[model samples]
Target: MKNCCQAPARRLFAYPPTSKTPTPSADDTVRPQPTPSKQNRGRPHSGRGTKRPAIPALPNFLPKLNPGSQLVMDRIYSQLLLFQLFFTGSVVDTIVKNTNTFARMRSEAGKHFLWLPLKAEELHSYIALVIYMGLLGAKNIIDYWSGKEIYRLPFPKSVMSRSRFQAISWNLHLCDPEDDRENSQKKGTQAYDRLFKIKPLYNDIVSACKTYFHPDRQLAVDKRMVATRARIGIKQYMKDKPTNWGYKLYVLADSACGFTWNFFVYEGKSSLATGKGLSYDSVMQLLDLSLLGKGYQLFMDNFYTSPCLFMDLLAKKTLACGTIRTNRRRDQRGTIRWLRDGKLLFVKWIDTREITVCLTMHMAYDGDAVLRRVNNPEREWERRRIPIPVAVKDYNIYMGGVDLSDALIGYYNVLHKTTKWYKTFFHFVDIVVVNSFILHQHLSKAQNKNPLSQKEFRERLVSELATQSSTSEPSTSAISAGEPCCPEYFGSDAASGRRVCALCKLSGLKVKTPMYCTKCNVPLCLVPSRNCFRKWHTVGHS
Candidate 1:
């Protein structure tokens, strides 16, 4: 709204006018009026050019144009709708109080300053952003504080201006104590002070927002991974080259209502260790716990099941339940009896290294007291082998009768909308789990509904997997003609398949070298050897 054409000067009728108008005696009788000047008629009657008023300029300036400025508002508005419906907006208020509320982050986590200038709040940008995004209803930063959106959000335009973007991107509050602060003192220097200095009065004022509105009760561990090429290619195992693809971040959020307990970012190989492996070391590391004990219930799939792994979990006091390897291939001489149909039956297999193990825990439960009952009086819980869907169950054997697979369950479920879309399955599962926890803690909880304890939760989960098959009609075809034989949740690129070690394929090649088997950490050689590795690698073979 600029006035491109300056208005023509007005002929005023006030004292000492730029142009003179008829002036009558102070107490004279009314006289005939003359034609009025068009401009002077509506113009304020003032001393005219004799005393001009000063106009001040407004101060938001930006050299770069924000591309998303146009859609920001609509995006925010729509996203806000979804966020409001799902999450209780208290996390936003909690985020605003990070430093001011926690108080410990500043003391423990924010110990050092960095070469880049910073404030206290910048130290917790990752966590704060999660809380802010989940609670504030902004999908990502592009939609929030946008020039067109947040500028109208009762905040000034400078907050989203292009200059501020560059100014703040450099580790603003990520300061290291021994960092070169003095270097920033001079102009044209990349040092902290000179690189981009805020006026001295406002310096060091960077800290957690003093005005955060929510308390701990309303807060949750919020997380968001901004797409990045590196993380996408590596963390999520998206094999596509990083020529242009951005990353995807998986976050654990508590928008439902709880404190943020843990959060992390994996640049590429998605949750291989944490989500799939259920590795004690991985879980402990992910939770940032030191010697938090090894025993804990690890809920996961077959990719994580192993006797050694099971023992590890038990050592840590963790109960692991999922599918287990029956090892029926080899007819060992030893007889292993399993409790079946309330009777001990001798099976052909034995507990031996010759037969490998593979299993997954579909659900995990732990508490002060434990109780379980079998639904069928004849079938014992230990012998009742609840099966996953056939498609996913035989995923590894899809190509042939049998092949090694980190999982077979994926093939059993095509994960279509008619079937269970992986996204919906996982999302539904997440909701069920989180909300169940909440229900147990705060909601009206019901004791196990089945008085007879007919079905274990895992069996129930498997039953839910039976598909309507098709959105229109229940059909068995999972992959529509020639569609990649992979689950939607399995990730897009099939090239992310695990790799075979050079030595594993070198029986006919050059000299073999000694290597510690990753799973067992024991010295093992290449040719004709199946060595046990102590530490679990999510990529089993690779």
Candidate 2:
């Protein structure tokens, strides 16, 4: 023990103290501070161990949508055509098949179920009735079919029988039973699919949404809750949301017209964890890469705002702006502090309270002022123009896309109470309708025509979908024998070419044919199922 300490003590004492301490000079009393480099001189402290320039003015080159990629008319003039764009024949066919299969399965299981095989036309009528129900809300589902004078609705009774509507509602399925059973048996990562029951329908709808319309420059990402009290594992409780207890869905929508471009159901902790953070991954997942790199501007809130995500989006040529959490990075020591790193701008501004925002598209400052009414010392309200950052102004303007969508959906929400969780598909139906309505507005504006209100649009849509066939006898004067209109071959061959039937188009049916009226010079279907030629002649077209 003595030997172990002796060597260390000798080394420590090797340097002897000076005999007399040197006297301190005035010059040595205080160390000279080094001069700041040009890069950092006069820069304000950003409270994060770095100095940054004062908030700069708004940049000139704000991202604008490419001219060629501007919104063009989809050429879908009818409400039915726009609706069919999202709910295609394939989607309808799948629903019909799965619904029939599920009904048959129930019958085989000895359940007291009377189910006729579902047809595509009948299913369309059923959906139309559902939309109608949303418009005329009743206390109970049976009220729409009730014989009582106050409860009776002619539309529902005419479109579908009460028994048939109940049958479809009870057994409607979106995925095949066999496939779902097989998938359930899978272990580990594959076994637990929260949306397994409705995955097929969900995929088709999402794919169609992306394919049909490209979003404009300003887009927003937010979460929406589908109100439900069903005892399902995926149900979430968001206290701040109006529909507080329900299934949560993250939606990316157009800020201009509230068009839902893409959405996904929020599963749970296990499914959402992606090594990054939940907020970061959720935003990344909802965004389509094809839509990026095209001068698109994305807006979000504190939930999804992070330096990493904004940088990643910038790298792809997509601009983003949103409020951020101070705890996520550094806290601001003073009001209106900002930091600029390359193209990224971080702003900590105080309005009513503190608000931290991160944006890549806008400059840190622009001489913009927003009017705010404040109570003066006399206890009277007075208006004042407060300076607002450009980022804050734009964020306030464009961050409500999802909220706008929710408001529009709620106005005529088709969702009804149900014990089964899969019935949440009704929410998606409402989403499709809203998207179609938005597209209709855009198309109507482009064509210099007034767009129908949402109520009118849905009414027209329901009527078109509920109509059974185009060949329905037209209520018109009978054709005279002296009329020269007669059916003749119009195309070189039936398989080579065809055109839309004049009569069928008038009846809101998209029927194509190779036969034409000799004198009228318009195509008309001559097939056995659709005798548009004879029907057109019978209708007395000149």
Please report the candidate that would top lDDT against the real structure: 2
lDDT of each: 0.25, 0.70
lDDT of 2 by residue, 344-371 (tens): 5676665666677888776554445555
Clashing pairs in 2: none
lDDT of 1 by residue, 1-542 (tens): 02211211332221110111123333432221222445345423322332321211211222122211112222222212222222223332232233233223433453221112223223223222322233234443444444364334422121222222222332222222223244444434333242112221111111111111111111111122222333212323334423133322222222223312232333323333444343333334332213123223233333334445544444444433333344334432221111111111111112222222122221110101112222334454422121122212222222121111101212221111111111222222222223222222221113322211112222322222211111211112321234332212112343332223333332222332334333122222333454322111222221
Report the C-alpha displacement of residue 516, candidate 1, in angstroms: 61
List where candidate 2 sits over 4 angstroms from the true fold: 1-76, 187-189, 270-273, 327-335, 341-343, 377-380, 469-542
The TM-score that candidate 2 achieves is 0.72
lDDT of 2 at 73: 73
Least accurate 10 contiguous residues by lDDT in model 1: 206-215
